[model samples]
Target: MSMLIDLEHVTKLYGNVIGLNDVSLQLSSGVYGLLGPIGSGKTTLINLIMGQLRPSIGQVRIMGSNPSWSGAYLRRIGLCPATDVYLPNISGLDWVTNQICLYGIHRREAQRLAEQALALVKMETACRNPMGTYSLGMRQRCKLAQAIAHEPDLLILDEPFNGLDPVGRIEMTQFLRGWVKQGRSLIMASHILHEIEAVECSFLLLTGGRLLASGTLSEVRSLLREIPNQVRIRSPQYRLLASRLMGLDEVADLRVERELQQLLVSTDSPAQLARTVAKCVAEENIQVTEMRSEDDTLQSLFSLLMQLHRGER
Candidate 1:
């Protein structure tokens, strides 16, 4: 299958400062989560995709065509920038409508689409309000409204839920979910791990302007199989469970936290251990309160990756 976006050994540099470093990526038509910190080249990659900045080296192809070569393909792509772009004193409706007009959409059609987009983000009632009067969350909705108004083939959003509250975030997530359910493509950049996990299991992690890893968390875990996996099992019969687990070849090390009534199990084969432990718990009817893999978290894995990248291991 052909990739919707392809980056071949791409690098972006602003003088001596590196924006991206020999990053190569291919994205098909699906939801992808871009994970990175503030200066990890997330925005630079987005800018390259949006054709706002040209790569210093290598090539970028969007929809099998060079994004910088023409504006035609941009019509099929929607982008919601992380930075603020609202024009004060203008009605939200007028702002989004004006954006649609840039695509040469007829005035009548643009207005209709704008209204529909605003409604999709649940901003129809406040569409006529001035941008200056809108809260941060409302402004975010306006940004989302502009992106989906055109119904582009691919939607790229950067830190899309920055200002949204919990309820607003849930609503926005549902909206994105429904959009992708229609077979359209989406790439979202967010610092929130759970939020990214909520929308997509696959991710591309970046750090220090370099690609750290790209795959599902489970797949990434497979890459660091040598690292001991930590599992914390809490139960009133913790000592019994620990004894059973220690007898298994799957358990490499075991520690008992008596005060916490938890047994920390270290295993080389976490996946297998998880399956075995789960089966044991169910079959034995153990009163296990919690069984979680601490080292399996994104933050922990990311930190380990960074350490490995820096030759700290």
Candidate 2:
């Protein structure tokens, strides 16, 4: 697959503070999630890719061309900014049509594209309403419509799920998923772990303006190979089962909660660990009630990576 976006030793500075430092990455045609805390250079990376801000050092390339205000690279790149700023007096329909025209489409073609974009975002019903009268979610959809008005090859969204209701978030997720199915690529920067998980995209985790990790969820999981895998086991006879399971080599640590009749087990070999637990249950005549991998969740993984990166682990 061709590389859609590339950052080579990119660095950005805001006076004395660092926005990004020696960040290097290559993205292809798929949904990519940028995961980071606030001030971790997520927004800085987005701006750099969208040609809104130039890097202080190194290079940022979108579609093999440098991203700059005058580069015209944005013609093939759609951007939905984090901010909600819009033309308050214009209707959503007019705003999107004007943007399409700016992208060099004829009046008729622009109108058709604008309406299609609004419909794609499920904002056609409120398309005629003034931007000031639209709700936050509606405005968000409008912003998305404007970005896709030209049907760019790459879509860049910053905090797209912020302030959206549950329904809106779900709708947005489905829309993004469908968008990528059409062979277009997306790079979304968001703080919400569940949102990133729902998108099921590769992740680029950043911290303190540095790239902490970048890969698929499972690939990132491999980075913390030394970190113990946490699992919760519930059995009919918890104490007896916990005692037997604790003796296995795969099981490194165990904490039995007598009140809840559950055992929180940390293990090194997740596959062997499961087999060992199964053997214990079979041999000891223990009735298993529940078993779940607790630490494999996206939030837990992010927490672990951030903690390790900060030297807090």
What alpha-carbon RMSD in Å does predicted model 2 have with respect to the real structure? 4.3
- Candidate 1's C-alpha runs over 4 A off are 220-299, 309-313
For candidate 2, the lDDT comes to 0.84
In model 2, where is the ten-residue run with the lowest total lDDT?
295-304
Clashing residue pairs, candidate 1? none
Alpha-carbon shift of residue 181 in model 2 (angstroms):
1.3
| Span of ten consecutive residues with least summed lDDT in model 1 | 219-228
Clash pairs for candidate 2: none
Q: How well does model 1 score by local distance difference test?
A: 0.87
Query: Largest TM-score belongs to which candidate?
Result: 1
For residues 93-131, what per-residue lDDT tens digits would candidate 1 score against the true structure? 999999999999998899999999999999999999899
Evaluate model 2: give its TM-score: 0.75
TM-score of each: 0.77, 0.75
Residues 161-265, model 2: lDDT tens digits? 876888999999999988888878888898766678787789999877888888896786575554568889998799888778767888889998888889999
